[model samples]
Target chain A: MANAATTIDSPSEATIRERIARHAGAARVPDRFKIIADTSDFFRVDYNDVVVLGERAFWIKGYEKEGRFGLDDELKYWVRRAIDLADGTTTILKLVFHEQFETRIGEVAITCFRSPKKEARILDLVADHPNFMHGRWSRDTAGNIIRILEYIPGRRYDEIIAEYGAGHEEYFHRFFPRVLAEYIELVQAIKFLHDHGEKHGDIRRDHIIRDSERQVNRWIDFDYTYRHGESMFGFDLQGLGNILIFLAGRGDVLVPDLYRDQRQLFDTLWGEDLNISYKNRVANLKKIFPYIPDSLNRVLLHFSRGAELYYETTDQMLEDLATAQAALALHTGRGS
Target chain B: MSTQTFGDLSRRDVERHLLVAVDESENSKRTVMYLADFFGGLKDVFITLLTIIPEPSEDFFPTEAARAKWLRDRRAVMEQAMAGYREILRAVGLEDHQIESRIVIRPCASIGAAILEEQEKRRCCIVVVGRRGISHSEEFVFGSTSNHILHHAKNSAVLVVE
Candidate 1:
């Protein structure tokens, strides 16, 4: 209860709608629609109220993938916000459309771990982990499988970064703590999955959500999480590291970097150095803003670049996150 | 010489059929005017003004009085909405015989599909419709009826007025 004053309220209905509309526009096709059933009795465009079935709302999320292969072509991967459709609800409907990919920049492996059953399994493996959304599964009449799970209400982590990370001296400091807390929580999330012998295949920034109330960050989408014969949670950890830099506005550093070249500072994130893989290194948060406190910077730096001293297990990462969170919080015990 | 179904027209006088969908919206009104301006004088065109009334909101119950009132209100609304369309078509040179109208009350399902089906069955060469030209994001959640017909009406050439 100590962090009461610091707990940010969720945006108003109007604001949420405006934001969802803007965010929904990111998808390539005209997709952000609710499928109206014979239940035409009720049709509302209010974003806060999702399409409800059997007294609960199911939110349909589609992240746009543009030209990952074809020139100017686009596709959206649909994920039904289940499990948490309601506070007590646990099953969700997940839709997937088969698509092809071709790209010279990277090996285009489409539909590798796209089984609904696999996502259900991953959720079960990480259930009660506080960070991963959990659910059960059943198929609809159309044979489209429904993965029921908790529906976490929040914007994507990257959406927030894109929305608020203006890097203005005052606003940056004001919003950075919560954003940092989200990263730390996500680290714990991945660590929790890893310790239990599971991997969250896709850990992209868009795959993570900062709950509407701004209380916690939750990792989402196991569609491409699994890698064949790939051991060690390092991949997920590295992803979390990259997301940290991304959430800090691509570490753009519009101002001159007094101590280090801006290009060198972001080498890990943008693949400036040929040697470092996208997941291997992450830019330091300090690169974005020199005013970023050293304690927070050190944690992100170690997580991003340091190998051995870095978090090998989630507990190790969790311990440091606790410290960083405590040092940065206006008050202890983030009970919103 | 033989007149088709409704009687009193010659077979050799077969008219090119046009199906135009109308709703309560101003865009639909624009569509009516557009059809009149573009196809009014086409050699022999039979124009069908189609108005699809989606089943009333969920709360309209099965009670006799409620059902009767719903029916009465829907007919009144449809007639009122189509009055302007009928006048515009007639004003543009279509006689009572050349121009006709029908209102469909959907028990359930899509207005777009109904328009396409009617256009195909009626051998309507061209389907005139109103395009709200809504944003993809809005169309994503709430589909644009005109946009759907334009893409899915394989048998008919759709003319959408924005």
Candidate 2:
């Protein structure tokens, strides 16, 4: 398996050690507890002090970038703030995890850690994708494991809504095509994970981070990530449906809401079920506002409609999303 | 009740901690069931059921007995409201220790703020609440609790169960 520590192909054992050596100075983190950056989202990680999540403390033997991203034996939430000494920028650090079991064996409080092996395997399994967060781990003198992960400097989905979604129906309308593409990338990101024989156990809007600057999406918190087996990938698909609705609806305001009512837009993804026929799905969405592009509605139905507009695989879902994206461009009269 | 507190839930190994804030509305009761079905499958989850009640009027009683009765009555009603949540959690296979229900009393009665406060204290990853709890007119005048949490709960994911 390729190393989860390095993004490119295998960084030799020496290479990994050298990269660690280089980053050690970059992530020197002046004061263990201090603000390293002052961006708009500074408070997002700054307000809260370094909370180890579950445990009171865990030690890190090497630089955070060198620590493997894996499960620990003790079950506790630990939040670490780290700075990139090279760029002097800070990113919040959290680990992809496993279930830690605590047992009472005689009088001793025996706590066993989750092996880092599974996380390493999963990272190697999905190594081809740059969107998945890279993880490394290090242990302190006490043997407490410190797992490290990629920290993207981007706003969460909710923050986007709060900043522009409050009363901006026109903004969403003008950017409908762009929104469709972003959603498409989101679907593709998941497809990559699913195609790689893994499933993101938990998929929420917050987990689908938007790197606006890079114009890309990254999935985080692999706590629920596991190898795909017999599942149809329905859970995450439906979750994407839910996310689309929330974004389109701009969140439910009891006073007739802003997004849906303002533009006469339909809540196509809301309460969608497999039983709903594809034609009816399109019809229902159109009834709300006739201008809703048929192509866009069709794509929505593919996920919502069980048998008729159904997609068997996410790869298929990705292909049709491309078609939908092209059609959306024409509908909104925008270039792809 | 096992009296298992959510405080002891392992933060490191926590699959997810979901906080559902409900009221006496049937929709609120349904919220618990919805949560049970949607997020119930996770093996290592902690569900905190929270309810907010109006603070008793200081002038409601001229005598100590009246105050006692008032407090007792409020507790009884809140406990009765929470019973359905307990039943649903049990029915869904959550261990006794995994379920926690708390009733918070605030005289000002800002249910939304209280819910956010509880979320902060517990650090719940998700906050699920019922959308039908307040009337449309009330929402227009007072703003809905769900909206307040939706806009303010930056770190915690907000789910409005309709």
* Maximum-DockQ candidate: 2
Model 1 chain B is weakest, by summed lDDT over 10 consecutive residues, at B134-143
Q: Write the per-residue lDDT of candidate 1 for residues A220-302, one digit (tens) a residue.
A: 77755322211134445545655665654444332234225656554434332111223333445555556655665665665
TM-score of chain B of each: 0.81, 0.82
Instruction: Give the alpha carbon lDDT tens digit for every residue of A5-118 in model 2.
Output: 222232233333333346554354223342212121223334322322121121222222211223423333334555433333454444323344443211212232333434
Q: Write the per-residue lDDT of candidate 1 for residues B1-162, one digit (tens) a residue.
A: 213433333442345677888877888888888878877755466778888776543222323476568778978988988877788888887677767788888643456877887876677778888877653222322345776686688766788788
lDDT of 1 at A15: 40
Model 2 chain A weakest 10-residue run by lDDT: A53-62
Q: Which residue segments of model 1 deviate by more than 4 Å?
A: A1-73, A77-92, A95-112, A125-130, A140-145, A148-153, A165-168, A213-215, A228-230, A248-275, A278-282, A285-288, A303-310, A326-336, B1-162
When superposed on Cα atoms, how far off is each prediction in RMSD?
22.6, 20.3
The model with the greatest lDDT is: 1
Maximum-TM-score candidate: 2
What class would a CAPRI assessor give candidate 2's docking?
incorrect
